[model samples]
Target chain A: MDSYASTRLTRIRTAMKDQGLGGLLVCANGMRRDHVRYVTNLNVLGSWAIAVLGPERGPALFIEDPWDLDRARRDSWAESVTAGPGLLDGIVRAAGELGLRGPVGVAGMELMEAGLVLALRERLAPLTLQPATRLLVELRLLKDEGELRAIRRASELADAGYEVFLGTARAGLPEYELVAEIEGFLRDAGAEDNMMILASGGVEVTGMRPPTSKRLQVGDLVTAELTPQVNGYYAQICRTLVIGEPSAAQQQSFEIFWQAQEAAMESARPGVTISQVAEAQNEVFRKAGFGEYVSKRYTRARGHGLGLHFDDEPLIWEGNDLRLQAGMVLIAHPNTYLPLAGYMVLGDPLVITDGGCERLTKTERRLFAVAP
Target chain B: MKRGLVEWDRQELPEGAFAARLAACRAGMCEERLDALLVYTDVWRAGHVRFLSHYLPYWSSGLLVLPLEGEPLLLSTQPQRVFPWIAETSLLREVRAAPALGKAAAAVLAERGWRRAGVVELQELPWGIYADLTAEAPGACELVDASALMRGVRLSEDGHEEALLTKAAAMAAAPLAALDPVGQRDWAVIATLERAYRRAGAEDLMLLVTSPTAGQWPGVPREAVLADGVLLQASLEYKGHWLQLSRTWLPAGASPLRGLYDRLGRAYAELSETARPGLSEAEAAGLLKRLAPGDGLHLFAAHASGSAPFTPLPGLDGIEEGMVVALHLGAEDRQGHRALVGDTFLARREGLARVTT
Candidate 1:
């Protein structure tokens, strides 16, 4: 529960040793560099690095870009460090520094283009270039306490933003104003940077999209799916609220959706098949004659993992074959549209627990009615 | 803006270039023996869509019904009775009302009486379509990942595309260099880039701003302080074009940092000179790393293009002639000192041309 970088690195090194690999090459730039920060604690803006592990050397960080060297070393979990450019050459140099030559297992080596692969092989002709896939992403599928905290913080920010909307948003208010308020609040609150899109559900059907200057109309469903990234961890919190008095059909739709969400959440637990959670939720809708409507209109998974990436996997869907594991943070929503009702959505963030799941989002998951 | 690169311009892709790419799509589909090649265009672009359709949809989503046989139709889901966006694109046959978008794809296909097809851009195609397309179609419409075709076509940037990126990089770099350090150790560079993007007429903006200090963040903007000699890698996204650039500012008089910076500048040029055309990216990356100073000196190893804060490059990139790249070169020590010099260039046979210049 005491999340530490070195401890994970040890587990990773053990995996590397089992694979008989010398080093794992990881690249980062722009937004995708979350993995680097997750590992080394250094955000290499425009750099590439390969983390090498030899039986004798333990672990080392070989980075190319100069800007992050001091920071990478200062922040890195590993003590063995070197800076240089050519990936294979840098790895080779790190390999040489550790006196590891003959055969070194490489993770990103197989991902190289045919030409680059040939060139690398030619350069390190005698050394064995074993194939190893990038396993760092999979390692992140499950979250520890520290990771959960970051996600929880992100979810709390989303909750605050929702509360702000609930208090301020109303019919006749332009969509962008609501969007701007949420983004401005998040930025000021010092949350992990954010990029999100919003949709004002008046336009026939609206998926979460960038806020236009579209004014909210009476009976409009204002849907907002905003993901504010926290140190590379992404939390997708989507909430739909009625602008004014909802139509009877719309209110009815919300009730059915509210029940479906409950069924799904109650079924989701550690070791449970993701499919079971999905089925349970769909069953609630199925009994209500909304089963066929869900399939036709509800086009996304019931829930997905929130932290690290948009990794809504071990996906809770009909055919999804992934099992939920403890500490896995997920967002669940049961949303669909019947011809009579325009749209319906119910969302909540949950953490997989020992027996079942813990609801992370404290928001009232229902049709948040707003008076114009 | 940095050391080299002063000349820059956005030379638009030729009028016929879009048509040619579409023709290439048709040819590719025929070769793959796939039915129809479904392409997409949207605001949250993957960047490859513009290479073929020539129309950059500024809305949430757009779809291209690129049949191996007929003229491609650009189905925009921006809710218009009239296709107002048709003027910007070279794509013909615009369908305005996609009332039931998920179901429309199959209806359109059935109306055309098409059976086998390949869908490109899997990321944009939602799960609903995956279910609808398979269920509604008469038989399995042999969907292939048309994205590979996109990657293959995008092996190198054309001269016109090169020009756009160059202008973006050059225009983006100047203001950043001239920027005064704000009060905080951390400042928002992406916000500044957006201002620069508007100054340079960039239709959409997505740039990377990274600082060694505590404040810089990715995608969205964040505040970070820029001390003397902090090397910032600012990858500018403009008018849907991407440009990679880096600069080191030595606030007036910082000698050792400046000296180390000068050394890196020389090394970058030297690396450029030696970077042969068609050099495998790994070879080119290796060449750059080998030049990185030994003990007393330091530098960022390097990646292929300056277009960062992140990329999917297995390493840097294979340096090819006529291809544009940002060779990142910078160094910082434990003293909170950093200097960076990055130049965008077009690889030539023996030498490289600084595209921004």
Candidate 2:
């Protein structure tokens, strides 16, 4: 048995044993298949899967198509991973192979369709099925060292991309055009996945998005939101800037956000629940009389998990109480925009540590002016 | 005269508006009575889904099942949080993880105790999802295709949607016009183009550009001057709307480029000729082909853009009156190189119409 497969099998075994589950099948379906990729190193976009952590013996990684068997052989170290249709049949067929049968726990079971669920019920007339969320969440929340490194790399590249963005901002530029340049730079800087949203129209403000052809005037509030992916790991960095000369109000807004951002950064630490992070931001905004914006005009928790998908679990919202743990990468931002009040954007990628949090990027969080 | 993209009233689309479209699909399903109509979409299949639901599904693939009658149910994956942002009608919904999609679907139908239901576009369903659905479906119920159901309503373009697209298409050139050429780097051209599209108020745009040399393979911008003789090809999209166009200028002499351009340009009748309902897709292709001079495939024009891209969106949606389309059929042969002429087109009920003619 390969090392990682054993590691996965052991974890699955523990999960089934812990949950009193007979079996737990993990899958990546639609946009949710990223987990399968995270575990197996196989980025199957077409909903491939693995049935792991059967109560008795262990688990089996299953692929939808037989064509991927060799890729599985080359990439996956699992000994019993197999291919083809009727995974439920495979689950039944491999029952003895797994050395356990009764009370199987299926994560994706309820999510199945009407007719198929009925048919599967007939097929699995003997066994039992439980909800898949808790088991899957258990496997996902714990990040391995390799995963941590990949996320760190993605974050560093994001910061470098921001540096390029700061250096490139100038007058007579369009919002989308600026983003394209940054995208091009990020691509060159070894970024594999990216979701960029930027905006820079000052007169009538709304929010941020991917750069548009809206030309940057002398005082346009250029906002760039970037998420760079390192091998499927997402790292987020958002920054706001001014075109040409910076206005006094813009400068003031930038400083306030800068202070607020530093405050939030300082507040992040291991053992602290995610709500603490939100509280830090809320404390800043509440001190400024923006307390009424909680869950309304402006959200209190703008921070969240930035992982496989740019936004992941454990959101930095008002009520979320997940504690910060080592190896968990979070995007902490205290972003709030009130109409006629200008912008307040402060966010950075951070990895939880034994004591405090470490920023993935070292770029200064102060508002910058575009050079001529 | 323009407005911001996101600033528009999302209510312009409204909740009940889609129900009518689905109801129309159900009417077609009843024509043969499909077990249920299956409309499938993934991150890759979002464009097709967007054609029905304004929400674009963001990243997850979604399935909307509408029976001949009764409430329609939408099934999708977990982390499937974006549904509400796009779902206005009570009709939209979500399923669990992707694995048991079939089983869940069957259970839903069996609970209803329906005997026969029709599905549309079953071919596009993911194989795993399909297999699971087939395996788990109630033995008493039947599943089949009713493609005619959705196709019946798919041809008609909505009023507000057309307005939004028209406004978006007009933006194709808005940023281009505002771009300053001097002292700008190669990436500046791309940036300028994006700004042009954004300033023009496009919702979600996918603009791809390449100088003549980069055609074989794609390349980033170079420090090249945007002067007269540059053959630039730009593929533009707004709100997942796809349009292709090309524009070129002749620094040497306007006569040759203009002369060659006039031949293809004739097909691009702005207000004089508009694509209406009766015009078959083949006829529009023929008109574009005629501009090509020999069966409509070759070096006369580099590219053209609209619904199906160089080829219009398939099905019965030919040039219909009141529909907006891009008429990018122009060329410049000053240096004997192919010309890139791209523009927009609008279809009117009576006379020919062109929005950015």
DockQ metric, candidate 2: 0.06
Worst 10 residues of 2 chain B by lDDT: B299-308
Which run of 10 residues does model 1 chain A get worst, by summed lDDT?
A: A108-117
In angstroms, how far off is B67's CA in candidate 2? 13
- Each candidate's root-mean-square deviation in Å? 9.5, 11.6
lDDT of 1 by residue, B1-357 (tens): 010111112245665766666677677778878768776544434355566655554444566787776677766665442253344244555664564444677777777776566766553354334445556755535455676665555554565566566667677767776676433333344444444444344433434444433422222234455543344555555434555666655556645566666766777777767765666777765765676554133322222332222233333345555445556655545564445566666666666677543
Candidate 1: stretches off by over 4 Å: A1-3, A13-71, A78-85, A92-139, A163-188, A191-197, A209-219, A319-323, A369-372, B1-17, B20-45, B54-181, B185-233, B244-336, B339-357
State candidate 2's TM-score. Answer: 0.60
DockQ of each: 0.08, 0.06
**Residue B334 in candidate 2, Cα distance off native in Å:** 49
